[model samples]
Target: MIMTKPRIAIAGASGFIGIYAIEELSKNFRIRALCRNLPTTNSLNSDVQWFSCDLFNLKEAEIAFQDCDYILYLIHSMTKGSRLTQSTFDDLDLIIADNVRRSALKNNIKHIIYLGGIIPEINYGISRHLKSRNEVEIVLTCSGIPLTCIRAGIIIGSGGSSFQIVYRLVKTLKIMTTPKWTKSLSQPVDVNDVIQFIKLCVGNKEVYNKVIDIHGTELISYNELIIKIATLMKLKRTLITLPFFNLGLSKLWLYIITGIDYYTISPLIDSLKYDLKANHSLYFNNYIPNPISLNDSLQRAIENEEKNEIKPRRKTFEENKVRTVQRLNLPMGWDSIRLGKEYINWLPKVFFTIIRSKVNNNIVRFTFLKINLLTFEFSDDRSSTDRQLFYIKGGLLVIKKDYPPARFEFRISPHEQSAIAAIHDYYPSLPWPIYRIFQASFHKMVMYLFNKHLIKIQNKKV
Candidate 1:
């Protein structure tokens, strides 16, 4: 009798760590690579099966994780999924994490492994980026299934975003004007070492349900790291530090030099202000005594780039689809069911003359000037006290509806004192440009007002 290897399902399998992970983990585990789009390039292992999954959709996540014994969650929601995204990265990350948790629970998966950022010891004034990462970690931890969260610092490798930022800065500028944030320290880990750590943690009973922080042997300042990179590159550069320089100027400077977008760079720059060395140091020290050096990692990354072997992760967006997420103050003792009802009642009251909302036979209608603008049917089967789901059945603003239709979700945040209201997979009747300007803007304004209303309700109760 032959024993089959444990099937490992990898989300974000086309990314930097995912690609490397597939190449490495395929040797030991039966690999099931889950991604939004199937990669155009060949996989290192021909036996690795690919499953196309849009992780934002819970049904898709459940289907993708089926038959897999362990899950390697490598997803990050920094890039846009639709043509226009009216949501913050944190909200998107939370939703995706919740979906993964639910999917894993329903499937009865054995273990989940999440790779996240190194959270600062002093939690005060944490950047949105790190906070988002921490929130994701929290969501996964509550899954009841065993979880191992490896919080790593700036990952050093070719094609990796963090490394590229450094590489580009060193290569591009001869005379660089730096901010005080450059003095902040970080323990940078090599991509290969990160992969090794993941390999060690897989099927290891000791590491399950633990948060491990791993990093390189040395903790160096950003300025020192940059100087080292410059030395390795054999380039002569002058650096002038501005102690009072603001973050806005730093963002613009890096954006101009690296040519990376503000969305990607903003969080990274914000995170650089705090020193983020690992706290749980000896967890994996016994297994891999000698980690890769920063100089060597930089050298290898440079070589890979010179050889044209590295490819950055690519994002593919759908046309005309919309996803909007807003975090609102949750009225104390209120669940999603009541929150959804409150939203319905509040909408008409807020815009009394122009808008009218009513529910008949569990079907909700929002009308403008007595014309049905939107229709939603309550989904009792898909809803719970913690989460309420409403399907967008038909509306004047809807041009075409996909199978299962789009949805509106009012969900209670597990840990935070807030509720999340989101619209998913919505396609408008208006032209893309027109919808983006008018309908999108209007929806955001309404949500903003609703948030104010919630705060007022809480204040009155207090």
Candidate 2:
């Protein structure tokens, strides 16, 4: 009798490690790509089957994991903007692990492999990202499925999120003054080596039910990593470390300078204060006799990035236009506030009047309010022509047409009705009382309605 190839499902298959894992495993195992978004069939091998399901949803996860022998859980929320804090990491990790484990149990998956971070001892206060990874591993271990957790240091590959941060910073800055943490130790691994270890774990029962640490041989400081990258790119760089700099502040500065965003860089910078060195004896004993070196790994990543051979095909606005529109069109309730005697009146009719949908998901809502005589501005000696016209959705409100063009633009969350208000009221001169009162009451009400309505929509979908 001939043995058949084992079927495998890879959640987060669209990510850095997951994509490479699929490529590496496709030749051997029957591969199933499980992700929130449908995998673009354009680049994937025809043998792989693509399934779309949100990992957090139990029913959706069940359908995605059905009939698979092995699962690769590589999902994380680093791409979710500013909200990717420690709490978000914990919530998302718990939810995803619970759903995936339950589904794995039902489908009788033989093994689960997770890719996680390797932190330094000094910085062991669970960062949102690290805590989340640790929590998921805990959930997986107790799930009854044999599990292999590969905790790795900073992945040094082009196109990977961590690498992109270091890459862009080194490329953009000529002289860098950074926090003291820049001198912290890290063992950066090549993406390909990480992928190779993941692939090797497929049928290796000895490695099952184990947490393995993987890293390149060299342990270098982050500043050294930057210098190496600068040397590779042939860019001149000078570095100075300030004693009192905060990671949070540094993250904001990096985001502004490099365009990588604060949420993505914060956890990385925070974790950098510790030594991330790992014991490689176990890896050598179980896996390849000689793993790829740091230089070889870096070279390969640079070459691949140059060749544009990475997965997920960085989406252009034209490609995402439809999805963007769909998200905008998703129904969200509206609230209108009309200027009043003592305070503004919060009512639906006032908020939704004269709403205009502009190009590229921009929306504007206009409302005209009658000036109340008892209002402070009306009590002033000025003539009674006082009327307030509020322009919202992009956070533009014109109390006076003669006011200069909007200095800042804002967008309302698709499922939330509240437009950020104080930006307009503070310009020219600050109106502290007016701004404070309107913002607190109106903003709170809008968020309340928006969340209430969003919950209803999600429940209805179920």
Q: Candidate 1 — worst ten consecutive residues by lDDT sum?
A: 308-317
Q: How would you encode candidate 2's per-residue C-alpha lDDT over 222-258 as one tens digit per residue? A: 8888888777767899888897888778889877776
User: Best candidate per TM-score, number?
Assistant: 1
Each model's lDDT comes to 0.88, 0.61
TM-score against native, each model:
0.94, 0.65
Q: After best superposition, candidate 2 residue 425: deviation in angstroms?
A: 33
Candidate 1: where is the Cα deviation over 4 Å?
A: 41-46, 309-317, 402-405
What is the per-residue lDDT of model 1 for residues 94-152, given as tens digits with 9 covering 90 to 100?
Answer: 99999999999999999999999999999899999999998998998888889999999
Instruction: Give the total clashing residue pairs for model 1.
Output: 0
lDDT for model 1, please. 0.88
Each candidate structure's count of clashing pairs: 0, 3
